[model samples]
Every structure is written in C-alpha cells, then in structure tokens.
Target: MMRYSWLLSTVAAALLGSPATADEFGDPEAGAKVYSQCKGCHQVGAGATHRIGPHLNGLFGRPAAGLEDFKYSKSFQRAGASGLEWHAETLDAFLENPRSYASGTRMSYRGLKDETDRKNVIAYLRTFSDDPANIPEADPTATPTDHDIDPVILAIQGDPEYGEYLSSECTTCHQASGGDDGIPSIVYWPEDEFVVAMHAYKNKQRKHPVMQMIAGRLNEEEIAALAAYFKNLDN
Candidate 1:
C-alpha cells in the first residue's frame, strides 16, 4: 500500500480530537519563505513568464493545464480533463507527489514530504490571485486516489488485417518497416506491448502530445486491431 506521509499530522491531530478551529491555514509570510524552494521551476508575481513550469499567477480555481502560454505535458492535460481543477486539496495532493498524483508527469521535483510545507507553499501561491476566495472551494483533507486497471477490459483480441487499415495514421511518424529514427518503428512488436504502449498514450501516461490526441480517439477494439497488425508485420 502507498503511504501518505503528508496526511500523518492531520490524521494524528484528528485522533487527538483537535478542535475544528485548528484548521491548517498557513501564513502567507511563512509561505513566502517556503515558496523559495519552488523558485527553480516556477515563478509568480508581475510579468511572470513560464519557466520549467507555468507561472503561478491566478492559479487558484484555474483548470489544470489551462495556461495558454506554458507548454504542458499531455499527461497533465489529461488530469485536467478528468475533472482536476486547481484548489487547495488538489494542489496539496499534487505537491505531495506530482508523479503519484498525475502518473508519468515530467515534473521531476521529488515532492514536499512535509505536509505543512505543502500547505504553506499553497498559501503563498494563493497570494498571486486577485481574489483567492473567488476560486472554487475544496475539502482541505482530500487526496488523490490510485486506480487499478483490469486487463480484461482490453477484451478485443488483436486482428492484423484491421490493424493494417489503421496503419495510415501511425505510419506517418513511425516506420512501417522495423527500422528507426527520431520516431521508432511500430512494426514487429509484441501485441501486448503494442496495446500497453497505445493505452499509455491514450491515458496520457506517456507525454507525446500528438500520440495522446491520437490515442484518445482510439477505442480498445481499434487499438487491438492496430496492435495486431504491427505485431504480425515482418521485421
């Protein structure tokens, strides 16, 4: 089972029966100090342009990956599509562990293991917005949940003939033959591998923008057909 170190204090406090008034509202001043830790990849305040990550200005209540200026990973966009709006809860869960919250995200930060730090940083970031209260409300104690996939869902077995029909779209970037360049060849791969790769793209666990878009358009049956075609092709 995955551990939630960030929630330990909150849980312990609850066990001790802390008063409701003792909510974990961090101080902006202290959060400003904590924000320094994030300065390497993010920026805020006036004229903040995107760095490794998007600027934090007006972040509260914004949809995930909604920034037009910053180039976000497709995985991040997928999280937004899955009803992930930025609120204190979402940010806390994310700051706890970006990769865990949004699987396969490119943000390499290890994570703020201390829950208070995450709260403080979020408090500081809230300052960037004009009216923080105007943003959406969320449960402060909420966290992201991991889901298990049932392999049986991909029930449609591979079909090579139909796979060839779908090759036109894939062949544009991937080599039809088993040679490779900047884009790798899809031909002659194991059917299972092909299916998993395609699903990864579809679910935005992989970062390629184009692949994510294409995968989103495909269904499990269509994907199985393509996988079958590629897996059966001569090397």
Candidate 2:
C-alpha cells in the first residue's frame, strides 16, 4: 500500500512540474480589451506605426530602444546601451511601474497595477512577436537564461571602502545621488543584479564599448566591492 501511494505521489509531482502552456500566462483576447488604455499612445498588429510611443509590433525579444528610426528617451537609450532586453521578465517589471523602471522616460502613464492586466497585455503583445517555434532562442516565449555566476564569486564579501575609492571612475557619468540624466543611475541597485550586469559587460555579452572597457579591468573582488558599495549607497 505504501509503495502504491508513493508511486501515485511521484506521478502527481511530475504532472505538476510540467512546463506551462503559452495560454497559461494570460488571455490574448482579454489583453486586447485591457490594452485599450494604451491605444492612444501605441499601436500593434499589421500596419502599426509609431504613435506617441513606438509601435508595439515585434516588442518581445527587442532590446530597450531597439528601433533605429524612432528616437527614444535618454533613459531608454541608456538602458539599451547597458544591455537591457525586452523579455517577459523585463516587460513585466517595466509594466508594473514604468517610471520606476526608467525614471527619465517620456512615457507618462502611471503603470498597470493589476497583475492580471499586465499578464494579459503581455500575452497580447506576444501575439505580435515572431513565432517562438521559429526562433526558439530569441523569441519571447523562450525561457530567459540567468547569468551563471560562480558560487565563490557570489559568496565574496566586498569591501565598501575600497569600492568607494574605485567609484570615482563611475561617478563621472553615473550620479551618486541615484539621479538618471542622460545616463541611467547605478546607485542603489541590488548587488546581484549589479554584479551580473558588470560581468555581462566584462564577458562581452553586453555590447557597450565604455562599459566593456571598464568592466574588463575589474577582478572578481573589485566587481563585488563595487556591487556592495552601489547597493548600499542610499543607506
């Protein structure tokens, strides 16, 4: 009896662990209705063109400010330059709070506070993107790969005093006050995100010339130190 019960539990667990279907994310039809609020500033589907905001076609998998012809805000430009890409996770974060995500953006709408609305809107936008089956790696439906930081690197306890001294080079463009001008603010970022971003730049996964140069010179300890300092800057 115990063996049979264990077998049943294993089968149930396997079923529950199966990958979610695309529809599970949200309903495109419901999303279209929710997207009415965005109609004034944006457009999607065939014949969509730039309105007050950039057209939403091909939004998934696009980098922040990816369109060449359309001019983007300095904050968005900075975000793109820093290797920010538009995936499900990123879009969700941006939709939850637009201004908080990009402080210098021209987007005036407050944000979609409802999680259902955000998911639905994202689903609707996904319909306009390329089919995931064709471009499995780059498509929005594909799961994003997290940066594989070594355990030793992540475990390193940084010296903030050393980081402060090293930060002079960064402060020339990034504000210490967490202000976003033409450049995106680096202060008060979560240490893990900051470290991962820097490593991305260092590894040439992120494409900014200056960032690559700066990050390339820093060792693991230095990177951790910078991460620690910037994360606690507000404190």
Candidate with top lDDT is 2
Indicate the worst ten consecutive residues by lDDT in candidate 1: 139-148
lDDT of 2 by residue, 1-235 (tens): 2223334544564699954446446677888999999999999999999999999998876889999989999878987877777866567667766765665689998888777777788878888988562342434432222335677887888899999988888999988987765667888877876776777678764557898899999999999999889988963
lDDT of 1 by residue, 93-204 (tens): 6776565556547889877877777777777787787663422232232233222224774566867777788888888887777656655556776665567667766876
What TM-score does prediction 1 earn? 0.51
lDDT of each: 0.68, 0.75
| Location of the lowest summed lDDT over 10 successive residues in candidate 2 | 138-147
Q: In candidate 2, which residue pairs clash?
A: none
Count of clashing residue pairs in every prediction: 0, 0
Q: What are the models' TM-scores? A: 0.51, 0.57
* TM-score, prediction 2: 0.57
Q: In candidate 2, how many Å is residue 107 off?
A: 0.5
